[model samples]
Target: MLKKIYPLVFFISLYSYAQTSVNFTDNFSGIESVLYNPANIADSFYKVDINILSSSTTTGNTYSTVKPLTILKDNKFGLNDLDVFKKISSLDATIDTIFKISKLKDLDSYVSKKEFSEDSNFYGNSTILGPSFLWTVNNYNTVGFTTAIRFNGYAYNFNSELYNQFTEKTYLNNPKKLLDNNFGNLTGYGQAFAWYEVGFTYAGVPIHTPTEFFKVGVSLKFLRGIKTYSFLLNDFTSNFSLNEDVPEDSVLDFNGSVSVSSSDTGANYGQGLDIGIVYEKRNKTLPINNIDKHGNIYYSKAPYSFKISASITDIGFISFNNIKTQTNNVDLNLANSNFAISDYLSIGSNKNQKETYLLPTTGHLNFDYNLNNHWYLNTNLDVYLFSKDRINAMKTVSNISFTPRYESQHISAFLPLSINNFGIYKAGFGIKTGLFYAGSSSVLTNLTNLSKEGDFFIGLKIPIYNSKVVSEYKKGIRKYSLLKIIENIDEEENTDSEL
Candidate 1:
C-alpha cells in the first residue's frame, strides 16, 4: 500500500515551485500582471502587449534544511577523486565528505537534523504561461487573453511517525514486536491537481479625476483538467503475533479504513473567474488621453503616488469523469490468508466514480507607494479562502510579500521578500530589459544552504509602448471622441505614431 503512494510524494518534490512571481507587479508587466490583479492592466504603458512564453518553478520543504539541488551537485563528484574535491577548499571537502557518508549509511540522510514539529506540511505549484496578449481598447478600457498550464498540490499536518514510515522503509528484521495494541493510529491527507486554462480579461477605469482614480477588472476562464489524485487516511491498526519456531508463519492482523481516488488521463471541463479593483491617488494628475492618427489611445504613464488593490482568483472547480476510487474497510490476518497485506488491500474493490475538485481559490491585497518616477515600493498579502479540511481540494500557501523596484521605460530591477504562513522567509530579485525578463524568489537562498526553498521565472514578449510622453500634463480630457475611433479600427495607421 505504501508503494502505491511513493510516486505521489516524488511528484510533489519534482513539481514544487513558487505560487507567484514578484515581477508580476512591474508597471510594464502588461498582460503578465493580469494574473495577479486584472486591474493592473488599466492605464498600462503598453498600447499592445504580446507574451510569447513564460515559465516559473519552485522548490521548498519544512523539515529539511539541506538544499536538494546542492546535494545533487555534490553527488556528481566521487569521494575517491581527492584532487578534484581539494581544488575547492578544506571546508568544502569536509562538508561534502559528511554528506556522502550520511548518504552511504543512512536511508533518511536528507531529513533535517533540527527538531521539527509533530505535524509537518509542504505546498507546491508550477505555471507555464503560454501565448497571451493585452490590448488597450480605448482611453478607459483594456482587454486581454491568456493561456496557461498550471499545477497545484499540498500536504498538511502529517504526523512525524507517518511521515517517517512513508519516507523510509525499514522492515522488522528480528521481529521482536511488529505491532502493539496502541500502535498504527495516524491520519493525514494530500492532493494534487493539474490543468490547462484559457482566460479573457477586461479592465476599465470608471472614475478618473484629479486626485482620485478607480479601476475595475474581471477575468473569465475555461479550464481543462489534466490530472487529479487524492488520498485520505482515517484510521489504521495492526497487530502481529510472532512465530519464533518458524519465522515465515508469523501472523499480522489489520483493520482500517482509507480512501484513494484518481482520474484517468482524459479531458475534464471547468470554469473559473477572477475579479479585482484598484484605487490610486495620483502623484501628478493623470495625463490627458491622446489618440494616434490611427485612433489608438494613450495614457503615457502610471502617475500614482500610492495605490491599493484587492482581488479574488481561481473561483471554480473541475468535474473529473471516469475516476477510479478505492475505499478500504476490513479485518484480515496475513497468516490466515494466502496473499500479502498489500495484495489484499489492492484487490479489495474498485468502482468508477466522478468527482469535482475545486481550484485553489485565493484572495490577494496589494499596496504600492511611489517614491518617484523611477522608484516604487509595494506590499502584498495572499490568503486561501477554501476549507483545508477537505482532502480532495487544492490550495496555495498563503504569504505576505514586500518588493522595492527601480523602473524606467526600457529597464527595471526589483527585490522581493516574502514569508509564508509557516514563517519561512524567501528573498528574490528580478530584472526586466525591454521585452525580456527573468527572476527568482529564492535566488539569495539558493546561493547559500540556509533556506529550504527556491524559485525561477523568465519570460519573453513583444510590447508596443506609448509612442511618447508629452511635455505638459492635463486631466479629464481626450483629444478624440470614442465614437470616432470605431471608423479607424479597420484603417491602416502608423504603429510608431508619437503619443
Candidate 2:
C-alpha cells in the first residue's frame, strides 16, 4: 500500500514560490491588480469597475513535464483510485532512472539528507468569483472590494530517509541511518476556503506639488474555512529492519509529534487585512481634463506619470474550532481493537480537535515608468514573509521582474521578463481589449514539455473610465433637478436683464 502511494502523493509538494502572476502586478486598469498590491488602486484609470466574473489557476510540482510513469502505463490512475489499488506494487530500473532527479544528493550533516532540494513545494488549484467592485469617485479618491474562493494544497520537507524507503523495493538499507537522528522535520497543511473582502480606499492630492503625488489603500477580508484537511510532522523518529528476508519482532517502528486528518466537523473563521501606499510623478507636460457624469469637468492628476508603490498584504490568520486534528490523546486508532501501538511507546497517540491556521503574508514593491504616451516600463518585487518554518503559510518566493507594455485608454499589451521565486527565468505575455485582460506568468512551462509550474489570470468587467464620463444634457445644462433647472434659467434671465 505504501509503495503504491509513494508514486502519487510525492508529487504534491513540488512547487516553490507559487503565485507568479507577474502580468497582474502592474495592470492598474484591471481590478485584479489590487490583489498584487492594494496601493495599485491609486493608479486605476476607470471611475467604476465591476468585475462580473474572474478566475485564475496556478500549479507546480517537482516532476518534469515528461512523466515516465504516465507514459509507461496506458491507463492512468491516481493513488486514491480504487483501480490502482488492485495492481501489484513494482519498481524497475527504467522507472528509477526517470525519477532519479528527485533523489537526495550530498549535503552537510547539519542538514537533513532527506531533502531533494532546499525548495520542494506545491500550491494551487485556485478559483475566485463574485462581482468585485471598484470606484474612483473623484480625482483624489479610489476604492474597491473583491471576493474570492481560494482552494489549495501545499507540502514540504520530504527527507531522504523517507524517500528511499518508500521508493525502494529491492534491498532495505540501514534503518538506523535512514531514521534515528536523520529523520528531519516535515510540515505541511492544506485547506479549501472562501473569503469575502470589502476594501475602502482614498487617494488625494499627493506628497509634494501637482507633479508628484502619494496615496494609500487598505483591504479588509473575512475568511470562512469551508472544508479543510491538514497534516503536520515535527521531530519524527523511525527504526526498521534492514533485512527483508527475515521477519523480526517488529518490522517498522516510528514515533514523533505528528498530526494527520481527513476533514474537520466544525466551522472555522478568520479575519485579515492588507495595506499599501503609492507615489507617482506626473508628466504634467499637458493639462488633462475629464468630463463627469453630471456634465462637469475635473482635472486628471494621474496622467502619464511614473508610479512607484509599496505594500504588505495578507497579514492575518484563521481560527478553526473542533477541527479534525490529530491529538496526542490516550486512545490509539488502528485496526483490531485488541492491539494498540501507543501502549508500548510513550508517543504517537493523538486525537482530532481544533487548530488555528495562518494566512500567507507577502510584501510587494513596484515601479511603473511611463515612456511617452503609450509605452510604459514596470518593475515589480514580491517576497514571502514566512519561510518554511511557519505553519500553513503561503509566502511567495521573492522575485523581481520588469515588464514593457503598450497601454491606451481601451487596449493594452505587455511582455514581461522575470526571474521567478525559484530563480527560473520566465518570459510571459498579456493583452487587454476594453475591460478584459488575460495572460500567463510563465509561458515556458505551458508551451513546452516542462511542467514545473505556470500561472494564468483572466477577468471580465464593465468599467467606467474617467475620460469617458459623458452627460446626456447640452452644454451648461442645469441637470441637478427640474426645480433647480427652472431656478437657474430664471436667474440667468434676471442677470441678463441687469446686464
Candidate 3:
C-alpha cells in the first residue's frame, strides 16, 4: 500500500530545515521579515532591500534524527563505499544470521528507522525565495514584493500495528498466528504538494504619537500549484493466513476504503493573504523630527524600546484541476487469494477530478524588548490554524521560541531556544553579515544526531539604508540621537585628556 511512499520520504530527506528565522525581530532584516510579519517593514532600517536568492527546509518526524545535510556531508567526507543498508546490515552478525533464515533484510536495525509511538506523525516543508525586493515609499508607508516556491508534506494518525506490517516480514511473510486474528479500525492520511507564489505587500504606520506607535500591513499573493499527491485511509480491516512452508503463498481478507489523488496536468491557480499588526512603546530618549505623513523622510535608527506584534499567514487554498483520483471500497472474502495488495487494489476505476487543497495557515505572536542600542530579546509563538485531521490542508508544526540577539548596522547575531508541539527542544544560532545570512534551528541536535528534526537555511540580499538620514545630518535638519550624542561627547572628552 505504501510502495510509492518511498519517493516522498526521499524527497523530504533532501530538503530538511526549519521554518521561521531567528532574526525576524532585527530592525535591519528588511524584506525578509515580510514572511513572518509584514508590519515589520514599516520603520525599518532599509530604504531598499533586494533578495537575490534564499532557500530553507524543515524536518520533523517521530522517527530518526538524520538530517539531509548530515547525510550529504557523510557521503562527501566519509571514505567507505558501503551504502547505508550495507553498513546497517553489517552492524549485528547474529541478527544478520537470523535474517538469513527468513531471506529478508533486517531493517529494524537501521539507525534512522521509524518508530511506532503513541503519537506517530511526520511533517516537512521547504521554501525558496526568488528575486524579491522591498522599497520604503515615504515616512509612513512601505511596500514590497516577493516570489517563492514552496513544498509541504505530512502524515498523521499512523497506527503502530499497520506500520509493523510494512516493516516486519514476520507479520506477513512467515507462518505465524494472526497477531490480532482481525485487525480493524485503522485510519491515517498523508499528503504532499508543491506550489509557487508571487506576492505584493503594503505596510504603513497608522498612528504615531509621542509615546505610542501602531503599524499595520497586508500581503496579497497569487499562487500556482504545480503538483500534489494525497491519500486518506478512512477505515481498514484485514485478516490473513500464511503458508508455513511457502511465505509467498498467503490468503488474506481485506476490507477498507481509501481516497487517493495525484496531479496530472496543467498548473492551478489560487489567492492567499497575510495580515499583521504591530504596536510600539516609543523610546522617549531618541531624538525625532515629526513630519507629515506624506513626507519623504525615514528614521535613522530604531526608535522603540519595546514592541508587540501579531500576524496570520498563508490564508488561502489551491485547486488541482487536472488530477487522477480514486476512492476505493474493498470487501473480499476467500475470493481474494494470490493477488498482491497492490494488484487487487487497482480493481477500481480512476477518474479525472478537481480537488481544492488548503495551505498550511498559521498564526504568530511576538514580543520584542530592547536591552540597549545593540542588544534585544524576543519571544515568539507560532500555532497552526487548521486541524491535523483536515486531510486537504497542508500541515505545519507549532512552536514557541525565545531569542537573544546583538544587532548593528552591518552585522547581527542571534541565539534561539525553542520547543515544538512534539515536546522537542532545540537550540540554534544565526548570523547576518552584510548581505549574507545562514542558520539552523536544530543546529545542536543535528550535530549530535539526537533530535528528531533538523534545519538549515542561507540567503543573500542587497540592502540600501536611508540616505535621507545622512543628508539631514549634513544639512543641519537633524542632529545625533541621544545615545549617539552621548557617545560622541565621551569620545571628545577622552581625546582632550589624551592631548
Count of steric clashes across candidates, in order: 2, 11, 3
Weakest lDDT window of 10 consecutive positions for candidate 1: 471-480
Off-target runs (Cα >4 Å) in candidate 1 are 1-23, 72-116, 162-184, 238-253, 265-267, 284-302, 330-350, 469-499
Candidate 2 lDDT (Cα, whole model)?
0.56
Residue clash pairs of candidate 3 = 17-57, 17-58, 17-455
Winning candidate number (lDDT)? 3
Which tens-of-lDDT digit does each residue in 1-499 have in candidate 2?
2243233444332222233343464444656777766666664566777888877766654423323223224223223445333332334323233233333121111111232543355555565756787787665667777778766565554443455454454435644444323333333343344444444444443544435666777787787776666666555544444443443432444555556554455567788888888777763432233344665433333343577888887799876675555434223232233565647444343345566767778888888897755578988887878875676564445668888988755678888777756545666788777768788767654454444556667778887765533222111122223434577899999999999
Give the per-residue lDDT of model 3 (tens digit) for 1-499: 5423432343344333335333344777788889989888986667789999988777777654444444454343232445533643452434334234323333323235456553467777788889999998877889999999988888777665555554565656643644335555567788899999999999999887656888999999999999998877777777766665765565667778888788987869989999999998865444454543566433334346788999999999999888887788777654334555565454454666778988889999999997765678999999999987776788999999899999766788888888898887888888887699988767876555566776667899998877665354333222334566778899999999999
Candidate 2 off by > 4 Å: 1-6, 10-28, 62-115, 125-127, 160-208, 237-254, 261-267, 289-305, 327-354, 392-394, 468-499
What candidate 3 gets wrong by more than 4 Å, as runs, is 1-25, 67-70, 76-114, 165-174, 177-186, 241-252, 289-303, 335-346, 470-499
TM-score of each: 0.77, 0.69, 0.79
After the best TM-score superposition of candidate 2, give how far the Cα of residue 469 lies from its true spot, in angstroms: 6.7
Q: What is the Cα root-mean-square deviation between model 1 and the actual structure?
A: 11.4
Candidate 3: C-alpha RMSD to true structure equals 7.6
